[model samples]
Target: MPSVPLHSSATPIVSAVLAFDVGGTDTKAGLVLSAAPGEVPEIVDIQRFRTALDAQRPGPVLVDFLDGLLRRYATEHPQLRIAAVGVTVPGLVDEQRGIGIYAANLGWRDYPFRAELESRMQLPVSFGHDVGAAGDAEVALGAGQGAENAMILVVGTGIAAALYIDGRRLRAGGYAGEVGHAMAPAPDGGLQIMEATGSAGAIGRRYLLAHPDFSGGAREVLTLAKAGDTVAQRIWAEAIAALAFSIAQAVAMIGISKVVIGGGLAEAGDELFEPLAKQIDQLLSFQPRPVLVKAMLGQNAGLIGSALKAQELLSAASSEPSTGALP
Candidate 1:
């Protein structure tokens, strides 16, 4: 979905479809439906649950969970005929092969996700990366709209980006957006991982490490920084700098026209973007400074992306009217 081209029209489908986005903390499910013919499906009835991944064998466990979910939905929404499924998960994925190559927290490697789901559920399954899916939604209907070249950064528990150049997403075999692991300047004059100094999770974690007595997360840390807490201020500033460095790196390589910031950190509003913009300016020389914008799709972008994939699959397989590909 990330680089599948920007589609703003309807997917040819006559039935309801299931879209699932599996996150580190929770798994989200939604039903997508088109109110009328020739319209994009509206994602509705969103639900979430604690993600339970078995370290030894996540494939079967996930399939079973999905099967149960399908049954529950069938019972709950009996009038609707469920046709296909589109699922997105985090980590390194092979979209073409429909394989989940690796996920450290999800504890899976080289798992045949699409095959297993289709074989078990007897429904067509469209699989992709979670962040990529989110990026797809952002581009299609969210803040990244109308941007020809951009980076959609999702800085949650971890950090990843969805790079769009010339209005096409750069998949790079699902390894394109692992910015959190990229090296950055550290306070100690040594290089540290970007997520260690940035990322919403890292911001709170580093603050807690510095002040064990603190009892809140990144929002609280930002508040403390505003109140002149030196430790909080330092942590916050370093996080911003790390993000700027990573964004600058992306700009240097591809000349992004806009940076759409999403995930938990983006909720900080001006607290994150204003300083991030300033730091990035200080780091750049002659590059076109990219406009920083917040993601408008909230946290359900992946669900929307997945649903779009499901509808697209249905359209491709059936005689439903669809806008095949639109730039």
Candidate 2:
């Protein structure tokens, strides 16, 4: 979405907060404003930017980028008070400490993300893992809304999961949901990471290996499979099988009742779900199978999750005693 100016003469300014969701390839930021105390926050000025790839000094680069964005928003909306900021990024995050422990793609380690941003902006900040945050949103308002124990699997370029058990999010210090690394059977009759066999990127890579001249992605491969291309059909079937095996393992371990699938691969709809559900059913003997569903929030789930976090921060601040007030 295109960025909108913070202030407009025709639009009334209201209390607002800032939220950012940083992904591997792009970053999405939003300005959430509340028109009424009980109304849902209105999201505006949604914008996307290329993610910063400064591996050498990712801390400073990220801080600078966030600072610049905050400065611009403040400049444009002088009357609007941004009570808090929420940032969600991929990889391991120590949310309680506001530290980004590690992101292999971004090349950041033990980065004090929240402290740096809060020091610069003088505002409360909330930090979390991207998939975790997205899963929270799903539980609170999306596909997993009514499910107490749900697992959200994001199967795009890579595969990751957000696990909720008995209505509680299981972070495990950002290591709980790295299902992509789980073991799965490879075509060579050996074990490999589940992502290598099931993820959308994996499908594209495997297809390219077989047909180097087929310059298409996972979606294209699915299309070809639908048209009865034997190679594409084989690759797609393997992906579904691997994904189903992983889901079955998760169910056996955690008793998750609902599985919400999202990301680019989920776009295949019943083409992916029917086979996956059937496979899981065949794999499980005594264990109860989960109801597989698609993610309802689409790509905006992370951004919504960030806004929810900011609202929580704002509420906490409001309930705290004023330290600088005259008694």
- Please give the CA lDDT of all the candidate structures: 0.85, 0.87
The runs of at least 3 residues in candidate 2 whose Cα sits more than 4 Å from the true structure, single-residue gaps closed, are 1-12, 35-41, 77-79, 323-327
Worst 10 residues of 1 by lDDT: 318-327
The regions of model 1 sitting more than 4 angstroms off are: 1-14, 35-41, 319-327
The lDDT, on a scale of 0 to 1, for candidate 2 is 0.87
Task: Choose the strongest candidate by lDDT.
Answer: 2
Candidate 1 TM-score, true structure as reference: 0.90
In the predicted model 1, the residue pairs found to clash are: none
Over 137-204, each residue of candidate 2 has an lDDT whose tens digit, in order, gives 88887898878889999999899999999898888877899999999988779999999989999999
Report the error of model 1 at residue 14, Å: 7.0
lDDT, candidate 2, residue 158?
92
lDDT digits (tens) for residues 1-327 of candidate 1: 466657646543346788899877789998887545333457667899787778888877887888788778767776667888889999998888999998888888899999999888888899999888888878887899889898999998889988899989888887888888999998678999999889889899999998888889899999999999999999999999999999999999888879999999999999998999999998888998999999988888888878777777777877656543311
